[model samples]
Target: MTLFIGFLIGCAFGAILFLGGATSYRRILGTLLLKDLWIIKLMATAIGVGTIGIYALDFVGLANLSVKPVYIGGVALGGLIFGIGWAVSGYCPGTCVVGSAEGKTDAMATLAGGLVGALLFALAIPLLSGALIEPLSFGAVTMPDLLGISGIWLALPFGAALLMVAFVILRERAS
Candidate 1:
């Protein structure tokens, strides 16, 4: 049942990505160039919805909160690599999957590269953990905890902010 539910969710997400034009390399390029705001809007909406849904689930005791250690150096390095990949290949990881499904060779390359990178990271983590992962670790902290606010309180405001961003992007796109 859990597997079936996950499969259904994955299908729905892929359908949304395809229908939203996130799978199109041209559309992704347009987003990178700031010529299109559709992807940004879509992502913002997803984040907003996800934030609210997650917090609601947690509030209702349907979900357990597990926070990962914040490794700022790792995030910065990952973001740099991600930005370069997105700019050069015009496919972020999720879009790469959708693009690959649609027979795009570049997407296939991007997916292959990503898998390779993941494998390499997995292989290297233990070797590099002391220098890379532990240096700047803030252990299991969340924004609400840091700010001394309730999770739900933080989530509502964060969701609202994301919704606002989405609204602005869509409004500008419409105009």
Candidate 2:
């Protein structure tokens, strides 16, 4: 049942990506080149809504929130790799999935490469965890904990900030 629910959600999200032109390599490149702002707006909107919705669920006692330990080195390295992939391929993981669904050969290749990378990472974890993950661990810091405030307090300001940023980006693009 859980897998079914996840599958349905994934399908819906993929459909949304396809319908939004997010699956297009050209659109992704345009976003990177700042010639198009749709993808940025879409991502910003998703982040904003997800932030608010997650917090709202928690506030209403409908969700249990958990924060993973923050490994600074791991995050930095992973982000660098991810940035490289996005810049080179113009397809982030979600977009890659959407493109693959649409039968794009390049996206299929990207997805295969991602799967191989994930497999290699998993295989290397035991060997790399000590040097790459644990030493820089900044244990489970949540915004509420860092700010010394309630989750709602932090979430409202953060969500608002994201929305404001998204609006500014769209407004600038419009001009």
Deviation in Å, model 2, residue 113 alpha carbon: 0.8
Candidate 1 lDDT, tens digit per residue, 18-73?
99999876677687778888888888888898899889889889888888888887
Estimate every model's Cα lDDT from 0 to 1: 0.86, 0.84
Candidate 2 lDDT for residue 124: 93
Worst 10 residues of 1 by lDDT: 166-175
Mind giving the per-residue lDDT tens digits that candidate 2 earns over 92-132?
99999989888999898889999999999999989989998
How big is the RMSD of model 2?
A: 1.8
For candidate 2, the per-residue lDDT at 103 reads 90
Model 1, residue 52: displacement in angstroms? 0.5
Query: Where does model 1 exceed 4 Å of error?
Result: none
